[model samples]
Target: MLALPAAPAAAGDIRATVRDRDGKPVADAVVVAVPSGGATGAGIPPGLAEEDQRNKEFVPYVLPVQAGTRVHFPNNDNIRHHVYSFSPAKTFELPLYSGTPTSPVLFEKPGVVILGCNIHDWMVGYIYVSESPHFAKTGADGKATLGGLPGGDYTLRVWHPRLEGSEQATARPLAVPATGAVDAATTIGLTPDFRARRAPTPGRGGY
Candidate 1:
């Protein structure tokens, strides 16, 4: 029998754990991996993402997306919300209306975009726009997996809503193999989340 050509090596997964300075599992922490050789902006799919406004809060709390992602801010509450971001990465507003705006906001820059609501001062969210597509968010257990990344050297970094220092301060070099999974761990200092603590609308029971 004739020999068939060898298949290209498959991409792998990068699993990471994030812990606070006190060794507590840090949830909603985003870990991003940028290619060390400066080849990025291709692995990530450019499309749609959502940062929902529900229960007087931004649903995901922390969202990680690649640059060029169009994120929809859908307000599902009975009350209208004025969603806006004053961050240098993205600054825009959806003037007081509910039920998914007609035009989604595009995230064209790579940085930390802090989201907030004018009407509800307690409402807050975060969007981490990564330069590379290889990234993941830590779960309640502080574990996150960046899957399907081709083997290569990467500059790994972590970001959190209340991180104490600049995101760049957590940078570390990583070497990913062409196959199988890699494990990484990072410890960071987090500042207390000082978001306004407003009482939920009488019996509404919200965050």
Candidate 2:
């Protein structure tokens, strides 16, 4: 019988935990792991992303998508919504509509996109277009796991809506091990959230 070599170990997973300056778990934060020296493999495949409007607010509040992904803005409320974003990453608008738009918006650039409702000034949301494919959003527990990452040097960073400083300041170098998982934690300072307060009902338009 011929002997065969054992299969190489699978890529390791990265588990990240985020907290605020006050030591409180932070939710909806975007965590990204970028190759320290640029990525060599094929980029993640493009896919459909969504930001839904319900109860006069953008669901999920924060969204992370790979560059070149198309995002759909679906209205689930009884009233129509006018969605727009003036961010440098992607600028687009969807004039008053009550349901899914005829077409989706393409985010070809890598940057932060701030979303708002022209009909509901209090409604705000974000879409983070990441240049790297390795990214995940923290859930209510303030934890996110990115799996199957080949061992290598990487720059790990986190982003939140109220983050006080530049996202670059949060970048931390990490060396992922070949075999098990890496556990990482980050604490972020936050500025006072000055988003417009939501009224009991849609009172006026213009954010």
Model 1, 1-207: lDDT tens digits are 999999975787899999998999999999998888777834858789999987788999999998999999888888888888899999998887878899889999999899988778888889999888888999999999998888888889999988888988999999888899999999999997788997555543332
Q: How well does each candidate superpose onto the true structure, as a TM-score?
A: 0.91, 0.91
* Alpha-carbon deviation at 189 in model 2, angstroms: 0.3
| Candidate 1 clash figure, as a count | 0
lDDT of 2 by residue, 100-170 (tens): 99899999999999999877889999999999888899998899997778888899999999998999999
Compared with the true structure, the alpha-carbon lDDT of candidate 1 equals 0.88
What's the TM for model 2?
Answer: 0.91
Note the Cα lDDT for every prediction shown: 0.88, 0.88
RMSD of each: 3.1, 3.0
Clashing pairs in 2: none
